[model samples]
Each structure stands twice: as structure tokens, then as C-alpha cells.
Target: MSLSNIANDPNKRMILFGGKGGVGKTSISSATAIYLAEQGDKVLIISTDPAHSLSDAFSQDLSGGEVIQIEGVDGDLCGLEISPEKGTEEVKHMLEEEGVSDELNQSLSMLGLDDLTSDLHQNTPPGMDEAVALSQVMQIARQGDYDRIILDTAPTGHTIRLLSLPEFLDSFLGRLLKMRVKLSNTLAFFKSMVGMEAEKDRSVEIMEKLKENILQIREDLQNHTETEFVVVSIPTLMSVYESERLLVALTEQNILVRNVVINQIMPRNESCPFCSARYHSQQEVLEYARQVFSDYVQTELPYLAEEVKGVEKLRKLASMIFSDA
Candidate 1:
């Protein structure tokens, strides 16, 4: 498919750009968001990477958890850089509201067990950022406020971990729920002997809600028509290898990959030995990519003299990527 096809596809509300670092994923994602916004659609481009480059790409100071509207765009274009630390804190607050922390502390105190409330406040579990980011995406998708949601994800490994989280969490939580059920039954048996009632199953409710959210995310991801994964890479052997791995992983998950963008292609210059050598090597890699990913749409972006920073440069980049050229 072409950029126009992606732009005009009604079902493509969630577009994700991911690949190895230094491959111009941020540039492409930002340009795509700008292209969509310029086409008269409201777009929200979010960076889930801990090391954010969206603000740098736009040449604007876009820090904090709030979304800031991009000035000068004819249509609505907003950007958000998610802070993983802040996201973990938000998750803590949500758990507090759900009474998870309170109930766990109370139950542990009664049983003379080690208190986990302090530990929970001290540290967020590993991969919490991906979990929280997924939740944020789900929230934005459900709101229907923006015409399109473009995600500039982290490097290949991190993005794959994020994509696989729903399934991992669903199964893990299922086991936890089962254990909680057994615990509840045991507690009820003891309470009955003393003619007292067991407490309500708040843990069960929380786990069930957690499971439900995971299922919702899984459904949205598996809806191939509505979600498109755009893999970005450079015209290099290593980049092509990583992109191929990403394609296989996404295919295994049954997620749809609409495009593979080969960025930073060196222009042919036979007079310059250095450029000529690089161009020839890049051609071989490109051919390999074309053969490997024959079923998917592929696009090449010429190497620019300067770095792609600021809205003007991004607009120019967008034109190149989206145009029929």
C-alpha cells in the first residue's frame, strides 16, 4: 500500500512506527502525523520511548504529561511524550483508587505478613512503562477525540515487548486470579469455623478488570484493518535484518504490517568512490529486503544533506514519503 492508501483508509486510526534506534522512526512517524493533520484530520502523535525525540523533531518544548497542540498546522495536531516514571505513579494512584493497596495492607497486617504497600510505592515493576503506555493508548483510542493516533515507539526489542504484553499479562493474571480464588476459599473455611464472614473479593475484582483491559488491547491490536504497523529501517544489512525480525514477530502475533520504509538511501554518485561504494552496498541490501518482504509495501527515502529537525523539514520529508515520487 501507499502513503495515500494509509492516509485515506478509514479503518487506519491507529498507526504505529517502530524499528531499531537511529533508523529515523521518529522522523517518519512525526512526518506521517503532520501529513495526516495537513490532510484535515486531527492527529495525536505520542512518543512512548523514555528518551523522547518528538520535541526535538518539532523544534518545540513539549515536556510533561499533557498534550500540546502544534501551532501553525491548519488542522489539529497534538503531541505527547509519555514519562515512564510519571506513568508508574499514575498506575499507583489508580491502584489506590481501586482499594488494592489498602486492602492488601490491611490483609497483610491481620495475618502478620510482610507489608507490601511500602514496596509498591518505592518501585514500579519491570516493564511497567510498556503496560502503562498500552493503557494510555487504549484510553486515547476509546475516546475517539482524534481522527488518528500515531505512535513513535521505542527500539525494536522494547516495542516487541510492549506488543506482547497483553498476552503475557493476560495469562499471568489468570493464574493470579486462580490463586486468589483458592485463598479466598481457604479464608472462608476458617471464618466459618468462628461464625464470621469472609471479606468481599476485592482482589478478584481488580484482577478481573486487569484481565479485561488486556483483552481490549489484544482485540484492538488484532483488528488488522484498524491498526497498521509501519516498520522503519535504513538501507543497511543490520537494519534490514532487524526489520525482517520485526516483520516475523508481528506476523506471528497476527498484527498487520502495512509498510516497510527504508530510510536514508544514499543517492548514486559514480564520480565519488565513497558514495559509489555505499550506494552499491545499499542496493544489495534493498534487493534482499524487497525479496524477503515481497508481500508488503516498501518505500525508500533519499538521504538528506542535513538532519530532519523542525516542522518545515518534517513537512518536506512528509511530502517526499507521501508523494507518488
Candidate 2:
């Protein structure tokens, strides 16, 4: 359904923002987080973009590795910026500490190659940062402390790949881990007969742990009540088209998609012919988006005079979202 309808749904616990780059998804997500916090909910906002600007949005430095609180909200309003490189390193550290050799352990570096993992990670495709983001989201959900979780996701194409990762990884890793375990056992038996000990494969063990994490995220997505995907787009032909395809992809995955947020609409400026013409052009694209998406559409946010940054500005945006003014 439309963003307005979904936001009105009290049972929805997670709100995700995704769209083409520079469509104001981050601003909308920040506003939503602030609004939820004002409504007496503990809200945790996360950014999956490598070039994260949540700290800029909040006017505070929030690059700490964990969830950090935003000072002004009435309820819990924490922010996290996930670095896939960092997450990959974290996994590698675990593997090495567990005693895998440098030669064999280098495979752990695979996790750092997001571009290489794009095809596999498309449905939760492997090695991409989106997987790290999803896992982080799952961790927050499992903790069960926050009333709401808002994610300022990457562009639509990337976000879709991330969302699909859980299922794809679940099946892929499950079967692979089983095979690895069997192979390891067989190799150990052969080494015993030769009077030599077989060393453990730390890479395999790391994969197994990642497999478990994927399974849990898959479970969380399936539950539906706790997670929802929101697609944000600008009032432009290209953005709308991308979002249309993204929606179809999500439906195929059986993922529960809640709303289509149309952001950064040109405000009516009667005196400026350029502004008026652009507004009319946006209106046409907006109309097309509504017709194509039907009930799933919501109006875009008007361009503001000043950049939306800091808790005070975000609160104003939250006000605008809920109010006519």
C-alpha cells in the first residue's frame, strides 16, 4: 500500500527507505525516525550507504562501530553506519583467531569484495555490504528493545540485492556447509591412516557462522510483522521506472513491501517559469507512478529552502509528514 497507509499501521515495526541516489531517502528516513521517537517509541536508525550522512543529518559525529544515541529525541533514537569492509574484517578476525592458517584464511577476504558478490548477493547475494546491513538489522530485531527500526538504505538496485540475500544465502550456505563438514571428516580419516593430523579449515567455520546469520535474517523477514521494505523515489520518469521494477522483484521474493515514498517534489513557484514547468513535469511522472503502482503510491516531499540537517530540522520534517502544512 501507500506510505501514508503503512505509516498509519501501528503494528509495523520496521521502516526501510530505498530509491535512486539523491532522492532524499535519507532525509525522509531521518524524519520518520524522529517522528517515531516523538510518538514515544524507541527508534534506531541505520544507514547502509558507504557514504553515510546520518551524522550530517543529526549534526553529530556517529561513526562509532555500534549504535549510538541521538540526543534530542524524547524516546530512544540511535543511529548506526555499517561499513562492509569493517564487517568483513570482523568476520576475518574471528576466523583467524579460531586458528585458520594465513594461506587458507585469505578466502575470508572474499567477503570484502562486494562487487564480486553482487550476482550472488542479489537475492541476499554473497559478499556485499547489504548482507552486513541485514545482519545488523536482524541483531537489532532479536534484541527486542527498540519499538521501531528505520533504515536509510542504499539505492533501489542495491537494496533489492540485499533484501534477497537472506533466502539465497540460506539455501546456498546450508548445502555448502553440509558438504564442507562431510569433506573435512573424510580428509581427517585419510590423514589418521597416514599418521598425520588434519588441520581445521577456518574458512569453513566462518562460512558456517555466516550461514547461521543468514538463516536468522531469513526467518525475521518471513515473520512479516516485524520487517517491511519501503521504496522511496523522486517524481521523475527514471526513478519511477526503477522503483516499478524493484516492486515486482520484491513481490517475486515474497517480501512484504509496505510503501512507495516519493520524495523531493518541486514546490510550486508561480513567478519562476522554470520552477512551474519542472513542477508540472514532476506531476506527470507522479501521475504515472500512481497509475503503475496503484494503491502503493504516496506523494513526494516538497523541496525545502534549507538543507534538512540536525534533530530540530528533522522534527520539522516529521511535522510536515503528519500534518498538511
Which candidate gets the maximum lDDT versus the true structure? 1
Per-residue lDDT of candidate 2, residues 75-125 (tens digit) = 778998877667756555565576434433233233342332232323224
TM-score per candidate, chains pooled: 0.88, 0.83
Model 2 global lDDT (CA atoms, 0 to 1): 0.73
Stretches of model 1 off by over 4 angstroms after superposition: 96-127, 194-196
| Leading candidate by TM-score | 1
Can you write out model 1's per-residue Cα lDDT over 196-216, one digit (the tens) per residue?
986664655775776677678
| TM-score, cand. 2 | 0.83
lDDT of 1 at 147: 88
